[model samples]
Target chain A: MSIPDTTLASAKALVAPVLDDTSRAQIRAERMSAFVRYTLLITVGFLMLYPLLWLVGASFKTNSEIFGSIGFIPQEPTLDGYRKGWETSTPYTFGRFFWNTFLIILPKTIFTAISCALVAYGFARFEFPYKKLLFASLIATLLLPNVVTRIPQYILFRDLGWLDTYLPLWVPSAFAGDAFFVFMLVQFLRAIPRDMEEAARVDGANSLQTLIYIVVPMLMPALISVALFQFMWTMNDFLGPLIYLSSVQSFPVSLALKLSIDTTEAFDWNRILAMSVLALLPALIVFFMAQRYFIEGISTGGVKG
Target chain B: MARLQIRNLEKTYTNTFKAVHGINLDVADGEFMVLVGPSGCAKSTTLRMIAGLESISGGEVVIGDRVVNRLQPGERGIAMVFQNYALYPHMKVRKNLSFGLRLQRAPKAEIERKTAEVARILEIEPLLDRLPKELSGGQAQRVALGRALIKQPEVFLFDEPLSNLDAKLRASMRVRITDLHKRLKDQGMSSTVIYVTHDQTEAMTMGDRICVMKDGHIMQVADPKTLYDRPANAFVAGFIGSPEMNLIAGRLDGNSFHLGAQSLVLPDELMARLRANSGSVTLGIRPQHLRVNTADGLRAVVAGAEFMGHEVVLHLDVEGERVVAVLPAADYADLDRGTTVTLTPDPGQAHVFDQSGGNISLSTSQ
Candidate 1:
């Protein structure tokens, strides 16, 4: 029939272009489009990275040279900034600040990792009385402004005689005070099929064993994300350490970086910038190493209705 | 190997939505029992309760000599293969198969040997080092079954294990699983299998006894032949066969079954049982049992015909009621649409159900 032939002709006509499209003009147009897209992406990427590039470049410049040029390439590069930055005016060296920061960050990361995972596991896997209400409260805490609770929390800590210690910073993490990580890990946990855990339970594993063997191993990517995030956040936490740590010896690198600038004396711009660059290294290394896990953790699943 | 007993098992979710009513079942040691039903029939829920994956609202689950209602899933001595296979994506096949044994702190060499033995049996030896994601769907299902097999539990619960597979793969896997059950039994391994599926074909092919359920209640439980030959009610009669039994609403008068503009004399035994409460009833006949070209039969018009290679299914209309009849394709090759034909139900194969769907033979109460 003409109807059948006409339908066949139209179908073939629609598909013919894709099958035979390698002409020079088409190739040039495609290449030009791709080239434009890449060029735009690269320009945007460079603009975003310019501040970091400038910081690293200015770290090696003299104080006067840093102000002279906003360009990344320093006129004359020197290690004097590094040398001077490493030696704090305090009797203790910058090594103590680095060590103190680790003391806060390592424990904080471990605590946040364990507490958040446990809380997220509870939220994701089980149905208990008031579970919905409790979870809603947890999410509500995510929306709560940190400044709203800051004064009351400080007063409570002062009442408990924890005024000038890392306890105030790392202790709350033990209770799963960071709701964002708990929420992210919970989403990752919920994405996993319940059958695996059921299989584990049937295989004779207890609740804790199921969590450790079945849930934790599958939750590794999200856990790594939680730890990486907690580490980066605690490392860069200036206000928390500044508020609690009174003694110079107890000061973390965040407080030490701010302490490097004597307002009465010259600003010591190059040394401060050099210390800032040094501070950025750990976070940078961590992010690059486990960035894949961080991205997978947040984007995997759990938003389905 | 153990006899598993579920007495009055019930599951009620929060907000008072009942997924499973009280269900009673006894699965003998080495029995291959299949729970077959449509979606929302609570077949999966019943299987989950038996596996201890779901908490029972009210029931007693006894495995062997133990009342395991309060016991944990691991303590129930059952292993389940889920519909999605539930293979741990991170673990290698060897690790997934050996996880349960390792969890119990089994001897390392024993775990290795058992893992290798199951891998060899399932023909997944080369896949021992590959992750679950690396395996195809069929391969992952084999690994999931291997994980359950290596445990050597008293009972194996399969929740639509082949539903995720393609038709060809599903057929092959069905045979493989049945063969595995036979081999395990022949080897004196006491393996009781309880499988659940929404497909009646799977139930008929794989189950030693099929339990047909609907709306959280079992309609009937019987072997494939008995279920096909004699269903307890209209639901079972209609559900257990493909193209479903043609169930037409009718009235059962003293000695005749009357439809819209058609009537058939009732067989003596059916008439004797159904004469008591002879108001509204459903007359059921399998498509294969409805014969065309009978000397004295109801008149029908051939509405459509489907040529099914060996057989041609002719959709016939009697007055306004649609009835289907299967005829040898070669013999009925010239049957045309809109042609008039005579259709009759084989007297011995017809089924009559009361208004409430209970079979006339079994329900004689007025």
Candidate 2:
């Protein structure tokens, strides 16, 4: 018994060192794999972000330095681009163009949210005579290319004497012309349980009241996504404003960016880059501010169903 | 005066699948009636119809003096507590409680008073500022109850309100709801409740009277005592009790109950209570009523024995039929598996049913 006990103790002592050595090896291997993974991720991420970084860096450079070096950093940064870019060749400043963009975005976003939510709610919850057919047509419009309707829409806007105004851009979205947003909201609404809506109805709320008090609050995330998409899209929309507004006073940032190129024989690279950065600012800021809800809306709508 | 009456309530889906056959029921004012059934039994559908959430294909749902079949849910004068609590996710508990009153454009002071009163009664005052998601399951359920309570509607509907809780919480909530109903009644408030659940324990404990349903039809409607002591059919007998009432198929000739290869002389009391003289029958006996190790009883082989602290549940095989007998643990502690024992069912507690699933022993037993 004593010999067996001694042998067992010796055997345990021998196995302990081997186990420790293997675990240490395993830890080192895990650390190596993790290091490789993070290094690869950081490299790819930086590569994808290089163009935006270069844009910001080149905006501060002089026109000569912007063309002279492939590197982003400038030897001497100056505020010349912003100062000169603000006062465009056109009579109005960049401020006027930004304001014009805001005017289009504000009504477009607000109306899109309201109109899309109402339409989505009806499609999701109600039973109408032609509901299936109507919804199918709505989806069909989503699948149709925007170019297909451009000529017809331009003709209609021209006949209405709305070519020189922002009505063509704002009126359609105000009437839920963005079928994609409506479809997104409808899908989101379908994922939500209707217990609270039923509870509201039981609590003496009419259909509209239930929509306002119960459905809208629950749909805030999806609604925020719709508003953000509309705001960004309208701010960046060049073709819609170009086709509708031919006047320099009503040019938005998207069309205004092209004004400098069209007016000057030799392009001032720094000024254009500066205004491009400023034009990108509103969309970037808004996207960051509402990023949490945007991701949640898309993910929950897709995954839960 | 808020008596709810359903006259031949029917529900047929658009696919032409008839979910509910025309069934009539009458629930008195202030009665705590429970609709209990297995899954797919349309108990929840019936409750939804009463609340006007589901379209009644054919029926007159008369609440008080009004025919509410055509009324919207909000206009039906009924408030419902849903299974998932259904508290407004965006509102605080106070707002949730006062939503119905605010919708009615009641006085601001009245809304405040009612909100506070309901909060105090449900013991959710501390959670008044919390959102529905922040509250625990029990707290959310209380808030849901307060939402319905504050409405002061003519009738209240609950669609398996406690089913989402764990077993322990469900048991406690069952008592809480029953106590709340009693408290409201004592205060002379109109608390006509139509609660639905599939758990028989909840139906047995919480309901003033239970309406047992099966496949969209009412199987039996009786107090818990009558439902247990004398189930109207084999389905009710099998569904009501734990370990279930043993329903063994056998035949009866004269005064002898022939069970497969064995036979037992029927008790005089049972023989007198029999509706049919001599034909095929299903013998229904509760586990507790089966006496073990009697000298003059039918022999059974003990297939299994579970020692449950104070009691022992013996799974026995009697003439190729499995029967469960619950006996006192102390007396049967030494009983081993595959042992032979005699089981004598108490004559007074045993029930006999005919071929059509109707209790034949109930008439003379009562």
Against the true structure, whose TM-score is highest? 2
Model 2: per-residue Cα lDDT over B14-81, one tens digit each: 89988899999999999999999999999999999988889999978999989999999999889999
lDDT per residue (tens digit) for residues B278-338 in model 1: 6888889899988888886778999999999999988999878888888889999788999
Superposed model 2: Cα runs more than 4 Å off: A1-43, A302-305
**Minimal lDDT window, size 10, model 2 chain B:** B357-366
lDDT of 2 at B301: 96
Give per-residue CA lDDT, model 1, range A1-305, as digits (tens). Answer: 25698889999999888766757668889999999999999999999999999999999999999989879888899988888888867788888999999999999999998899899999999889999999999999999999999999999999999988889998999999999989988888877778788888888888788899888888888898889989998999999988888999899999998898853277788889998998898899989999998887666663211
lDDT of each: 0.88, 0.91
Per-prediction share of native contacts kept:
0.86, 0.86
Q: Could you give the TM-score of chain B for each candidate, in order?
A: 0.96, 0.98
Give the runs in model 1 whose Cα sits over 4 Å from its true position: A1-49, A68-72, A302-305, B267-277, B362-366
TM-scores, all candidates, are 0.92, 0.93
How large is the C-alpha RMSD of every model relative to the true structure?
5.6, 3.4
